[model samples]
Target: MRFCELTEQEFRDFSSTHELHSFFQTPEMAKSKQEDGCNCYYVGVKKDNKILCATLLIEYKGRLFKTFSSPRGYLIDFRNKELLNFFTNGLKKFISKKGGTILNIEPKILYKERDMNGDIVDGGFDNSDIYNNLIDLGYKHNGFYLELDLKKQVRWAYILDLKNKTEEQVFNEFKPNTRNIIRKAIKYGIYVRELSLDELDIFKQLVDSSGELKNFKSSPLKYYQKMYRTFKPLDQIKFMVAELDLNEYSLCLNKELEEYNQKISKLGSKSDSKKKEYQTQIDVLTQRLEDLSVKRKGGDKVILAGGMFILYGKEIAYIFSGTSTKFRNFQAQYLVQWEMIKHGIYNGYNTYDFYGISGDFSKDNKRHGLYEFKKSFGGNVIEYIGDFDLIISPLKYFLKKLISRFGGK
Candidate 1:
């Protein structure tokens, strides 16, 4: 086995035959950073004509650092112990010759479940998973330092699944009252439409509402517009809206009120139980209807889907939705999600991902509310092995520490 540096086109061609993640970790990104005076390199190891592994390295403060980003450093070095050793040795020599003090690596791989429980499983030369390869390579392990697992890692924007199931399956997925409200919404002519680029002002309204409530960080509208144009050709993205009808809202409200009145007037036997249930239903329905009433002018109040998502492949579709304060009671946000999920399923996506449920699910945790909302959808929560780092050099390690504390540009 041997290791060497690859040019941009060379890496891209190599990646076409391997995983896409390898291409992301190509030397080119590092080289681009280097042109700005940051040292960067792309290195790969091969055996018998097979590219076994690749990594990206950047030089900062005379020390080599590993970025190990997605689709780039998505290292699957697990099965190739001989190649990993060769690669690591090559990295040491390459950086050292350039006056680099150390090499740091952060593999885009997760630690196994039991590995987290403090069991140091032996990594063998014959191991297949790259996570185990890191262990065998004499890389230090810090169990507590971790990030979300890959399976559950949510991209900023995504799609959801709604296929192969009956409408009842869709309805059953929501909170009971939520299901009825959407049905009621339909009865009142509440409709959903795909938003177009020219109609962005309407989408902005929804973005602002969501940003405020979630304290979400976002690029400006120009950023989204650019994205809309850039990824549009891929056809993996779309913007959707849920529009309300105030006239329908009012009618639904009146109809429910009439039903409640008749039940009370008839002295329907078991009147107390019936009245309590009916009254609760009426209160919920009325609140939603009243909320919809505000949008009655006919132009339509829109609830926008949160982001640009990639769904050209893979089974899971992720989402980043937010709601307007004005439409909170109307459950417009819920309806929007319901529609998105249905969209995913209909389009052949298996999972409708509500990304980023907090790892800490205890009641006191800040993310508990989000955790619960995602849980309500009935998918089993999967926890991924978190991120891990590899120390490239001892001297540079302390140097970075010094730079962090004492300050260095």
Candidate 2:
């Protein structure tokens, strides 16, 4: 087998059929990285002119030398020990030849099979051998962390399996409260529409507002524009925002209120519980109608929430998302999620990924709401093997580490 540089088409042809390929490992993502001043290259191992394994290396400038990362790592079978060794050696050589100090990789391999609550399944399939293989090959283990590191990959993820399931089945699997929220959004006449490229600023604003509320900084608008320029034409990215047409919703509420009044007037049965339930609903609707009148004075339409979806391989990932705090009662974010989940089911994808959750599952965890929200959709938690750093030059790598320790660029 020979390790060589691959053309864009060569890489695409091989990755299109590879079992481990994800959106991150694509040329489109490489182009997006290029927009950020990162150099991108594709390298792979081939035999008999057939490509076997590949990676997209993203090169970033380091303090003393160039550093690199292979996002989602190589497209190779981690279970194949021989192949893993070959790919690792080739990557190490490739980076060293480029005058790099350290190489970072986080493979798309699961470390252990886990259940819904982030617990290891009983005697479930595991990838401990691959972990050991990486260490034996001189790749320093980053260790399995149970909290968000900010600088490293959030190793844990949540994925809902959409295989062999109908859209109704998927919807029914959501928790009762989650289902209620979606229904509430529907009742509020919230609907999702795809955002055009020019409208990304609106998405940017919402996400930025949410970030500020949480004491975090959001990506600039151009970051999303660059992503659009790279992935939009390929139909691999989707940005959807939930909207409410107040005038139309007002009509719907008026009709519903009339029906409820008619039912109350024609009440013949003495079911006090049912009567109270209907009356309570009527009162709630009345209050909402009053609120709508005031809101409509400002605008007939309003955007409540939005999200970005990355469609690739057999999964649809709900990656970046945001919502307006003023419309929290509408819960339009849930509407966005439910609609996207149905989209995945309709498209015959294998999984719907609710990306990036803290590993701390405690109730007191500040981000516990994130975990709980994803959990309500009913899916297994995924734990990847984590990252590995291959030091190309020990001395240079040591200096770089020391510089980073002291907050030096």
Candidate 3:
């Protein structure tokens, strides 16, 4: 096998058809990263002029030495130990020749096949061999992390498989409460629409607030702008916002209240259980109407939730999103998800990736809410093979880590 740098077209052609293809591994993403002041290049290992594996390498400068990262790296067969070793050796030499000291990698390979509840299937497919192969190739494992770590690529994800399933089938598989929330969002005039370029600031505001609450860094407006400029035209990225119009919502709510009252005042055969159900909904709707009145005093329309998505190849990735706390009870976020899920299903995509969640399944975990939100859409948890660092230049790698307080990975 021969390892060499590949042209953008060459990389794109091979990556688009790879079994492990993802948006992150695309030339478009590489160009987007370059726009963000990062250096990127395409590299591949070839046999008899046939591309066996390839990667889009992203380079970041540190205080001391430059660090190279292969975000969802090496579109290669992990089972091929020979190919992995050859690629690692060639990559290490190639990067070490430059000022690079560390080569960071986070493969998208699944670590274990886990159920919806996050428990490993007793005899499910395991990739410990792949992890071991990587470790054996002189890459240092970052260990299994349970809590949310936004600094690195996601080591865990939630994916809804839409293949060979009708839209109704997929919708019915969602948790009952989840479906109810989605329906409630729609009934309340919460609608999802793609955001225009000028509308990113509105999404940025929500991201800032959500980041603060979750204790993670949020992308700046420029980052979104650059990404939009680079990927939007290629039909690879989408920004969606959920909106609420108080006037229409109020009309709908009033009609719903009248219907409930009519049912409660039926002349005969009223069960206590049915009455209690009607009363519960009436009380909730009344409070929402009151809140709507207050919000209407401020404005007729409001953005309740915003999200950024990566639409590439066979998948639609819900990459980043935020929601307005004031409309938390309205469950606008649920509608935002349903919007994209339906899009993915109708567009012939095979997967809807609800990206990033805490690996810790414990209810007491602070990040458990993220897991629950993703889980409610009826998808299994994916614990990915986590981050690994290949020390290209040991001395500079340690020096850079020391200066950054070990944040280089």
TM-score of 1: 0.68
The number of clashing residue pairs in model 3 is: 0
Instruction: Point to the candidate with the largest TM-score.
Output: 2
Q: Rank the candidates by lDDT, best first.
A: 3, 2, 1
* Weakest lDDT window of 10 consecutive positions for candidate 1: 152-161
Residues 1-409, candidate 3: write the lDDT tens digits: 8999999999999999999888889888888888778899899899999999999999987555688999998899998999999999989888987779889898989999999888999999999999999888889999998766778888888899998778899999999999999888887778999998898998998888777776768888998988888888888889999999889899998999999989899934659899999989999889878877789877889988889999988899998898877766676888999999999989999999999888888899898888899999998988998989999998886677677774644
Candidate 2 global CA lDDT score: 0.87
lDDT winner between 1 and 2, please give it.
2
Task: Kindly report which residue pairs in candidate 2 clash with one another.
Answer: none
Error of 1 at 158 (Å): 13
lDDT of each: 0.55, 0.87, 0.88
Q: For candidate 1, write residues 67-179 as lDDT tens digits.
A: 22223254544455776677777776776676665444544343332221123345612212665666677665445322333342331111134547765676686666667
lDDT of 1 at 139: 61
Give the per-residue lDDT digits (tens) of candidate 2, residues 165-214. 99889889899999999997787678999999999998998798688777
TM-score of each: 0.68, 0.94, 0.93
Clashes of each: 14, 0, 0
